[model samples]
Target: MDALLTVVVPVYAVEGFLETCLDSVRAGLTAEENAAVEIIAVDDASPDGCGALLDAYAARHGGLRVLHLSSNVGLGPARNAGLAEATGRYVWFVDSDDRLPPGSVRAVLQRLRSSVPDVLLVDHLREHPDGRLEQDASSPLLAGPATLDRLLGLQHTAWNRITRRGLLTEHGLRFPAGWYEDVPFSNPVLVAAGHVEVLNRVCYHYRIGRPGAITATRSERHFEAFAQYDELYQRLDRLGAPAAVRSRVFTLMINHLLVVAGNDSRMHPSCRRRFFRGIVGQYRRHRPAGHRVPAGPAGLKHRLVAANSYPLYSALRAAYRLAAARHRATERPPAVSPDLSATPRPVQTTSLR
Candidate 1:
């Protein structure tokens, strides 16, 4: 018999806080939910003692299981391993560094049972070390079955949701390993799911100050995103994505590339024109609809940025060649210590702040 839920957590060098993570997960679950929740902690062969710690947890806890990988397979593969081991009817992917507040597991389980949607989303609250809570209202709960096109331009952070196991398995959803993995991995899953449910209640407490987070260090990984979107587009095309959905996907990719390009003047000043040209060129190949997506500052910025970036593919390429390498040598998130940190870890607390 399948377990009710599989909570897959990919653990890295979080030994500094693994116990806290486990405590929180344990605390957040209801008695019944706890019985149903099978913790699959994928130890990515961290040089730290996280693997041993996971083993310890498994030794003490009947519901928790430890998976020790021979090599660090990165987030996507670690998660895939957990899924392969999951005997749960439902699956929720949670980061090991973060903690769930009280009742979160129960809430997610209840939503899964009542709604039975292909996916269920919970709002996440940003907690600063100072004990203040900033709500992530980016995605208020969305109701009913959502389509691929509708989910486009959607604010997605996969941690804040519980996905139906059948939906994922049926659609063959899996994350693409490496940087910017979420978009290619998540968007396709959301698209494939026929129905989705979202809750405004914040069930997740995201820990931002953790070391080596995606945005915590600066690296060439992001620049690779420009090419990643291109890959996503190619996959979508091969998959024979719907025309409307295809257009939305392209537009989304264009928007993401523009946002990141604008941030790095050196990279964009060099690559923008060529990159923009490539984008427009590829976009034209797709043959989008007569309805020009509403022309806004973003669209205008995309056009202007594209223009500024062009005609100097040589100079841009030259700059990017060095910049990515230089940036690659640097740490990710590029900056140490967030300029702003909020306080009071956010807790769903059953709809209470």
Candidate 2:
């Protein structure tokens, strides 16, 4: 039997959550769908017995495979290792701290078998620490093939998308070994894909880990995001995704920098200063060069920051937050949406650009 899907779950030090994740996956699939799946759990040299857990899963499951990294490579490298080993037509990368909401692999594969999109973006459920379930609010950014406006202007995360295996590997695509590597690779995926599928189903359950996730900690890349922003902006203009693409990109850059400004001591104080100054410079460049101003909270946040210093900035920021909270008070993910419709997959595809 040919495997239609390869599910890559990077094993980090989530000893507390690993078993539940695996068991949830096991319960989600049936004999036939499970049989058609190849599960790869890359143990990223976790010291917390996660590698042994992967071994145990491999021992019991006929379809499970383990990729044990020699050392603690970051998220991007661990995923790259799994990508190198994947043999499925489509790839679904699930974080160790998260799990699918049953039959998701089969659903994703069923869609890929016919519609054949470069990637399928699914709605994700974000689980709060208190066990409240709210569907992720940012899954619908790409209306079709990603444009510069869409990639940069809209919201995105790595957790809620499925990539076609051949398209990914043929391009020799791999995650950059950086803290927020997904930003670049994901943007490129949409840029390079012919068409993308947007499913409104909440298939993946993402846990919200405040104060502990690497994203909360300031690092070298935390400051380097400005460089990445500049690079993407230049690349998008070169690609001609549209002027709208630049608008989105501007929004992302502003949002990222402001968040850095708000970050207290997580990043080096000097690094924050450097990042802020760079953003101020970037804003000046955009203003003179005539880039579209970013919209929503991102744009408002940046404008407020540009006009004020510390205590004033903080006070103004609170108003924006309250306004945002009101805007989101009534929005919710679609309860019933397009599932794996029986549409025939496309036989040919070209670059989105």
Candidate 3:
């Protein structure tokens, strides 16, 4: 019998965290639940000892499968390789640097058996460097509705969404090889899914500020976001999605580009102008008809993007940063001195005699 769920983890240079991720998946699963789930770890030609680690772990764990690729394909293609080998009814593309919380697999299995949705969206906790856990702000939206807009509004990460394997195969959906691959893949799955369900519980722990993380690394590859969105628009056109959906996606694309433009960690200071120009080109190409820009500062940024005014956009961003710094400075609490004027009192002690 095929397993009910397949956890596809694409491993790269994540030797430091792979064991925690693998262990967490089986942490709270019962014998029966364990039999119902399978794990496929794709070693994307990682330069570290991740492949050997995977093999050793799989030797100990019954349902854990490992695939070692000869070449270093990026995360998307590695996930594709794992998906190709998956034998479960549903597939989850989990990152090797992240892990499921205890009981998360059980919760997901329960939901899948109950609702049988084509797609199941779960919330995640962002694990900061200081060991703090914070729920994603968008978690509240998952409980409201399963609408396309709502799904699109959620984080465009692949791990949060558990999709039926048939839904993906039937639609010929596969992650493209590049950065921001989730944008092209996740959105379309949500758009094409016949029925969608949301699990409000925090199921995944996403590590933030980790070394070698693409989001935190400064590189030119971040510009690939534009190409990813282009592919997304093309897919939407083929799907013949409604105007409203297209409009929402357009806004989302612009907002995403703006975020990339503003993130110092992702976009280098020297590349900001070129990235902003690319955003302008994208705005001109994919802007849906009769689309309304969002309100306030976001709307202003949209206008600047439409006008292709990189200079003004840069200035606006600078001003906003300055204001934010000032606001933070003003909001800081003053240090207080401890009082030393209190009279001394006799200490009371309890005797065990």
Each candidate: RMSD: 7.8, 5.2, 11.3
After superposition, candidate 1 runs with Cα above 4 Å error: 129-131, 140-150, 234-240, 263-291, 305-353
- Per-candidate total of colliding backbone pairs: 19, 9, 0
Query: Pick by lDDT: which candidate is best?
Result: 3
Q: lDDT tens digits, residues 1-353, model 1?
A: 56788889999988877887777777845577687778899999988999888888888876788899999988878998998999888888888888777667777777677767776666566665554556544543233233345545555556866788887777667776786766665666556666666554556777764557765544546655655566666656655677777777767777666555444432435555555565565555543675355486556544544455454534544565688789878854322222222122222212100
Candidate lDDT values, in order: 0.66, 0.67, 0.86
lDDT of 2 by residue, 1-353 (tens): 55777888898889888877777666666788777678788999998899998898779765788989999998888998998888888788888887767666666766677787887766566666665666344545433444434433334556666888877766665676756666666665666567777654566777775445665565666766656556555555555555555555556666766766666545666665566667677666654245545566555667755654545565775676688778889775443222422222232233355
TM-score of each: 0.76, 0.79, 0.92
Least accurate stretch of 10 residues (summed lDDT) in model 1? Answer: 344-353
Which structure is stronger by TM-score: 1 or 3?
3
Q: What lDDT does candidate 1 reach at residue 84?
A: 92
Report the CA-based lDDT of candidate 3 relative to the real structure. 0.86
Pairs that collide, model 2: 114-344, 114-345, 115-345, 148-245, 149-244, 149-245, 152-248, 152-249, 153-248
Q: Rank all candidate structures by their lDDT, best first, as comma-separated numbers.
A: 3, 2, 1
Q: Model 3: per-residue lDDT, tens digit, 1-353? A: 89999999999999999999999999978899999999999999999999999999988876799999999999999999999999999999889999887778998898899888888888787877766666566766766655677667888889999999998998888999999999898888888887777777678888999988998999999989989999998888877788989999998889989998999989999999999999999999998899999998889999999998988999999999899899998795332111211112222111111
Please name the candidate that would achieve the greatest TM-score relative to the true structure: 3
